[model samples]
Target: MKIISSKIVITVLLVFATVLSFAQKDFQGQAYYQTKTSLDMNFGGRQMSEEQKKQIAERMRSSLEKIFILTFNQSESFYKEEEKLEAPAQGGGNMRFRMMGAGGGEYYKNVKEGKLIQQADLYGKQFLIVDSLPKLNWDMGSESKMIGQYLCFKATAVRKVVGGTAMPFGRNNNENQVEAPTEYTVTAWYTPQIPVSQGPSDYWGLPGLILELHDNNTVILCSKIVLNPTEKEKLKVPSKGKVVTTAEYEKIAQEKEAEMRENSGGRNMGGGGRGPF
Candidate 1:
């Protein structure tokens, strides 16, 4: 009788292990993120007429209201922007495009392997930026908030931004003019129910999925989530574009910014001229 009971217990244990394995493998999710930049381009002691401000605001509308999608599993996530068609070009116009938001690249983060792949575009060129995941020190708070149907906990962290400018390593404009070193507070609300250390763009290292986050003047909120959907494909890491390290990408981006500055006759046009991310 004892031997028979032991055999039964072993069989039950095996079945339980198999079930857990299936659950882990089958869990997947997609998060929709919308980020709005409340950036006042009137900084730097530059003032424009009301008409010029209105025109610039019209041109910056699409850039300010941006959209992103993130597909994630237990340990990995893939992020990209939803493309939009721009208006037709004006005749005999030399209008150039600048990236005004935090979206210069497509990001992939793997928490398990501690690897990251950033697909970035610079000066009409593409680059596959490979580097390690950014480590953010989060201070979990007891306060909680509701995001969609999930109960999320508030967390805060201070991130050391390279400088006042976007690109910390760019040497084009801040040479003689030394901008102050700065930092920004990042606030996020994450829920442990999903159990994935993933979020929009390059944010990660959380106890759960970050549903909403805000940093400086930019706010990224998750409006919807789809969990364990039937129509789904496997997560893939982006490999296309010239392979380079994170530092190398910064160098190339600064060079491009310098070239743009030179072309514009030492004028810092289009805000900060999209640099390394």
Candidate 2:
């Protein structure tokens, strides 16, 4: 009887310890992010006057800057664009160009379940792109930086960047296409205090929440963070769209994009008139 009583006491103590640990950890929060892309107008800069280039840069700036909100809890996150802006359309003129990038969809990631759902649209067609959650193999660094009073530690990872190349110098009408992935180093600064494996877009697998991320010409920084806010947060999984695997959606997207470009006679710029989802 005494041995059983001691075992019971030990079990009770263990349960109490687990409860304390869980209560102290924060798992709910909202992170506001601002993304900025540095435009390279060098392609047509020399051909145009200084004033014209400035105007183009201004337009690009307006298009490139965007705001996003990422609400997360523990191992799940939902990221969405705050503003849905219309893509610029060109009306058959001398020059045809527009800023281009990805991530115009409802992004949801569940690290615990190893699931990722992206509600995407390509040329008026809706698709639910399903794939595994992004897993970044990070090399933690001793270097540190402060982002909005939160002390963040630096980490780096080599990631494959897809769809980087643009149409070469030519009419680009009836040219072939195959998007190949290229390797690029991604730099991130995360705060360990938050203890959530999350970042902007398709980046994850850090020891903490990533505060700032840099990838080539684009940079995403966390502007604000609210931990366990008074407002109720819902990080629900999205389930409304034409479901398709990542490979399937890629094939469909490429085919649709090619068809649109051909239909527009190279006049369509900025993803061939695809709207932000």
Candidate 3:
């Protein structure tokens, strides 16, 4: 009787341990975000009528607003744009609208490892930016707000703006005429209820999961959160593109943009008609 009882106890313990292991491995979360960026319509300091400004804004609406998904676990997260067909740009002009140094492709961040890997498609070439995650010193505020079902707290950080101060728009002739700000103030609203140190885009390091983030002219807000879904997202690290450090990649991008401008003779490359105003 004693031997039979020992066998039964061992079987139950093994089954419980197996179940626990699967649960730990499958624990994950998904957050959906809506992002919008504003653009300065003053092209080359050129005066334009309100009609023209309205037309320009309407044409650039698709690129200015987008939806993104962040799939994250306790120590890792992957952020990327939700897949959808983009509308064809109006008038097929030579000038193309693009977000300068914008977040493109997949961004993988491992908080535990303090590592970041981003896939960037510059011009037609691909680049994998592998570097340490940027550290932001956040000043936690007493302010609180409700984002969806979660109560969030506010935090602010000041970060130096890298690259040139170009508006998030297509290349315009008056780009050099506009003076860009050298610094940006980033504000984030995080929820300790979620208890994860992750956020959309390059914003992170908060004590909780960031639900809303504001950086300069752009805002990213969390629209939905699903914890431990039945199906899990494969949080795999991105490996495509030419491997380069963050500094090296930035230098290469700057050099290429300069080359393009020089070859185009200082003209707006995408705005083939009267110009991008």
Candidate 4:
């Protein structure tokens, strides 16, 4: 009788272990990130009163601040902006600005398959950018810091800056142009405790989960993390867009912008241009 009882106990233990393994395999997490971009209000050597500058800054606030969410499992993740109602432009006839890159639409990454799929709505058309995951050569540093409750390690990478300019307010002249940076020095902070190689936007390839990222004038920081949440996100690759590679998409955008400029007789279009985001 004693031998029989011991065998029964062992069998139950094995069954529990098997169920736990399955649960671990399907683990999912959600991370909330707050993103902010700094604007350069230099005014191009033109003297402007402090009150005017403040008003201009207020006009740009809607495009500068945002919240995003990253839903992930072991190999698949989706990053997207959390939808919220933006305030109307403060001044009447003020043009509302939105940046084109990063946080455009849905961004999906499959680390195990080395694939990237992005859904972008550009020029009144939807485009799916199908490309390999960006190959970033991360230089892991010894520096460490705490973001929220996680201890994060520093990493750096160099990449070409994404170029786009915002139309200067109240001026159609070329002299007041604000040049986008030509190079991007990205600094990322990742926490090994999470053991997932995922980050906001196009940043990844770290040994752990990235909690903070600094790219040129923009900063993305993780504010909250929920491991194995109640509602699991179905990580589906986005499919609602015209198929195009990254280069093809960029060429199309440039051509469309040129055509708009030519049609408008080389004048700014309703104060519209890419904002710093």
Top candidate on lDDT is 3
Better of 1 and 2 by lDDT: 1
List per-prediction Cα lDDT, in the order shown: 0.71, 0.67, 0.72, 0.71
Better of 3 and 4 by lDDT: 3
lDDT of 3 by residue, 166-235 (tens): 5323345454544556667889999766766899876679867899988766778899988889888799
> What is candidate 2's lDDT per residue for 58-173, written digit by digit as tens?
65554468888899877889988886666675332334333334346788998889888988766556788888976778998667656876767789988654332554222464
Relative to the true structure, candidate 1 has a C-alpha RMSD (angstroms) of 9.1
Report the C-alpha lDDT of model 4 over 1-277, residue by residue, as the tens digit.
6755554465345445444433597798899998887755543345777888788767776666788899988788998889887676467334422354325678899999999898887756889889998898899876776787666778999876433454433235455565555556789999866777898876689977899998766788899999888878798788998999877876776666656655655444322222122
lDDT of 1 by residue, 1-277 (tens): 6755554465355445444533666678899898887755553345788887777667666666778889998888998887779766534234443444455578889999999998988767889989998888999866765687776778998876531253222234553443544666889998766667899888899877899888666788998888778888677788889999877876666566557656765544343422332
Report residue 43 deviation for candidate 4 (angstroms): 5.8
Candidate 4 lDDT (Cα, 0 to 1): 0.71
Instruction: List candidate 3 stretches off by more than 4 Å.
Output: 1-25, 165-178, 267-277
What TM-score against the true fold does each predicted structure earn? 0.79, 0.75, 0.81, 0.78
The better-scoring model by TM-score among 1 and 2 is: 1
List candidate 1 segments past 4 Å from native: 1-22, 49-51, 89-101, 163-180, 269-277
Query: Residue 163, candidate 2: how far off, in angstroms?
Result: 3.7
Q: What's the distance in Å from true for residue 268, model 1?
A: 2.4
